[model samples]
Target chain A: MNKMTRQFEGYSFIGLWIIGFMAFSLGPLLFSLIISFFKWSLLDKPVFIGLKNYIDMFKLDPLFWKSLKVTFTYAVVSVPLGLIVSLLLAILLNLKLKGMGIFRTLFYLPSVITGVAAAVLWMWVLQPDFGILNYFLSFLGIQGPDWLGDPNWALTSLIMMSVWGSGGGIVIFLAGLQNIPQLLYDVSSIDGATKFRQFRAITIPMITPSIFFNLIMGVIGAFRTFTQGYVMTNGGPLNSTYFYALYIYNKAFQDLQMGYAAALSWILFIIIAVLTLLVFKTSSSWVYYETERKG
Target chain B: MNIFGKSVTYAFLIISSFVFIIPFIWMVSTSLKEPGAIFAFPPQWIPDPFLFQNYKSAWTIAPFQQFLENTVTIVVLTTIGTVISSSIVAFGFARLVFRGRNVWFAILLASMMIPYEVTIIPLYVEFKLLGWIDTLRCLIVPSFFGAAFNIFLLRQYFLTIPYDLDEAAIIDGCSTFQVYWRIMLPIVAPALVTVAIFQVMNAWTDFMGPLIFLNDQRNYTLTLGLNLFRNSYLTEWNNLMAIASLVTVVPLIIFFIGQKYLIGGIAASGIKG
Candidate 1:
């Protein structure tokens, strides 16, 4: 092929993506930033009111702070808790035995029933009066709290629900676990290390990359939490579950404060970006890559 | 491992798996119970007289048929667009030598990190300007543009193919497009299937996209339809479970059929990251 044809062929392959990136991804991103400066409800022409929306978010909107508190609290609690649960699940399921696949599948089944369906099912599961969780708790002579109804327990309930849906994390960790060389365990065993010692020395360090991956993703996912609060609590029990994303949704769709919502979303974007960068910065200390040789 | 250790491991696994799957069993049990029987003390594990009528009522009482049609339209079209467009773009990044190829690929990777919530409001406004609000096109059109994740996935798969294969194909007078369409696509079939399956699940379970763009009852996706049902029929536990099960089962069925590809995709995403 001539140079012209070769270049054309190459560009043709990527042309669709360039168009898509410009139109859908880049364009909307920049436009949302622009809209953050203007006071535009759907009906009105955008009026430039540059810093008011951002300033008001910080000073005037108490719900903005409230939503941030709720979301950060959820992320702080849920992310580590979810990491521990999923890692443990991965360890147990890593046993090289017959019928392990069935157990893995059963464990993963709940995550597939995600989004609205999962949210609705948990609403019943966390129902105050006749929920299966409370009913099951009764057998142990413990009274379960009114989970989604009480202000204190509502966020906790959502966190627990998130743990149950940590099947995706489990699968990821399992893959990471399997990647660990059996030779490491063999060497540790030969050195007369205890099982716990072997795990701490060999297992944990090896899976730190997966841990790091899940932690970053988990933080981002937790910050974007909306459907659970929207569907189950309606951000209620005195705005206890008023997540940041839910606040954004209500601002844009319910209150029709498009400009304010745009600003809220930018704040959220900055929070996530900063948090992700912080994690990436910290990853060098803990995350172990197999390719990196010890100096 | 010793017998005691083996037995303990088995016991722990069985117990945890039961705990994991119990809610699903509860959902099914609730869906089949008589409406009054749902709150039965000690919670009837199984319905004595199974109420199959709940499913019928959930389906009949709403415009579920229309909802299903709307969902199918969006899922099918988006899946096709995602598979074809993503792979073609991926082939370019993997094989075709071009100026700024690495830069473009880097830009694409960076774009993936931008959260969907950031651009959603502006996109909604853009769709409204195009008069696509309350329409399925708003949901479907975006997929025809290659998704970053899907393109990245297929690009990985394409790069794994030996370059000699492409060289031979080119020497045989196959054009770049022909090489991608014929040789490269088939070799990367697994990745294509993986992308298609992920898109189907994403489009199927997507609540926010439809919520933002689709306002008309006639254009409601299954996620929107189920949310509406939950709101209007707050007290109908049996019917609610039935409809929830109906919505949940489609993806469950799809997962079962595409279990290998789906799990492979998850593992690839984690490990590659």
Candidate 2:
């Protein structure tokens, strides 16, 4: 084939993506940024009010601040908790033992049951009186908190739910663990390195990239938390669970503040971008790339 | 490892596994309980009557059949669209050396980092303007354009295949399109399946899309239908559990069936470039 036709075929192969990217991703991205400066409520004409939406968000909107606080708190607590729990689960499952496959599958079962179903399941499990969690707590003579119902425990309850879904992360971390060369551990054992010492020296460094990967993904997932808040709490019990995404949903859909919601989403975008970049910036210090080390 | 240490590990594994598995068991057991028996003290691990009738009631009480039809429609179409389009796009990136290929691929990668919330509002407006809202087209059409992650994944898989095969096909007069359609696609069948399975799970579980796009009750997907069921049957614990169990079990079954590919996709995405 001539170079011209070859080029045409190449472009044709990727043509759908180009159109989709422009229409779905790039175009809307720019549009969202533009509308963030306007004051449209979807029913009226948009009036460009540059920086006012942002200004209002920072200074005037109490729910904006509340949403930010709630989102950040959840991200701060859940990301690390998820990381540690999943990492430990990965390590445990990584041990070559009989029936490990069943245990691994059992651990991962919860993650597949996502969205409204997971929320509903947790709601029943954490029900104040008849829920199994509280029912089990009674056996120990310790009263379980009114888990999704109480303001103090609503966020905590959600955090606990996050742990149950750590099986997804466990699978990723298990893959990372298995990627480590057995020779490293074999050599360390011969050199009289304690198991803890070898793990600290070798295992930790080898999986740092996976840890870094999970951290960024976790941050993004944490900030975009919506379904649980929407279904389970409806951002209620005094808005304790009013996740930022839910707040955006309410503003855009319920309040019809499309412009304001656009601005809010930009703030969320900036926060995620900055956080991910910061992780990337610091990753060089701790995230050990085997290829980089060799080079 | 010492026998004592092995026993401790076994104990820990058993306890943790119980914590994970108990929710599922609780859901099923609760689904079978009579409504009055749901609040029985010390929570019945086994329902007294085993009221499987609740499942029938739950299905009949809502438009669950309609919901299932809608969900299956969206899932099947989106999976087909995503697999075909993403693999073609990925084939171009993996082979076909064109000008600005690297830059375009980089842009695609960067685009994946942009949160869905960033584009959702404007897309909502655009879809509304196009009269796509309140319709399943809004949910299914854009997927035919190719997703960044799936494109990236299939591209990686494509790159792993030897160039000799493509060359061999081309030397025998297979056009680029023919090579892509007949030869390269079959080689990357496993990756295509991975993408298709992930897309199915994604389209099935997706709540926000159907929530924002569809307003008509008849148009609601399973997730939205499940939410509506919860709202209307707020106090009917047995019925609610029955419906939730039904909603949750589909994905559970999918995971069990596609366990290898699902885990492989997750691991491959996590640790690979």
TM-score of chain A of each: 0.96, 0.97
lDDT of 1 by residue, A1-295 (tens): 6788878888888999999888788998889889999998889799999899999999999999999999999999999999998999889889888788998899889889889999999999989789999998998999999999899899999999998988888888988898898988898889899999988988999999889989988999999998999988999999999999999999999999899999999999899989988999998888888888577
* Model 2, span B194-272: residue lDDT tens: 8988998899999999999999999999999989988883548788889888888778888888888876776656483
Fnat of each candidate: 0.66, 0.74
lDDT of each: 0.89, 0.91
Best by DockQ: 2
User: Distance (Å) between predicted and true CA of A161, model 1?
Assistant: 0.5
The two-chain DockQ for each candidate, comma-separated, is 0.70, 0.74
**Once superposed on the true structure, which residue ranges of model 1 sit more than 4 Å away at CA?**
B270-273
- Candidate 2: interface RMSD equals 1.5
All models, RMSD in angstroms: 1.4, 1.3
Task: Indicate the docking level reached by candidate 1.
Answer: medium
Among the numbered candidates, top lDDT falls to 2
Q: What is the TM-score of chain B alone in each candidate?
A: 0.96, 0.97
DockQ of 2: 0.74
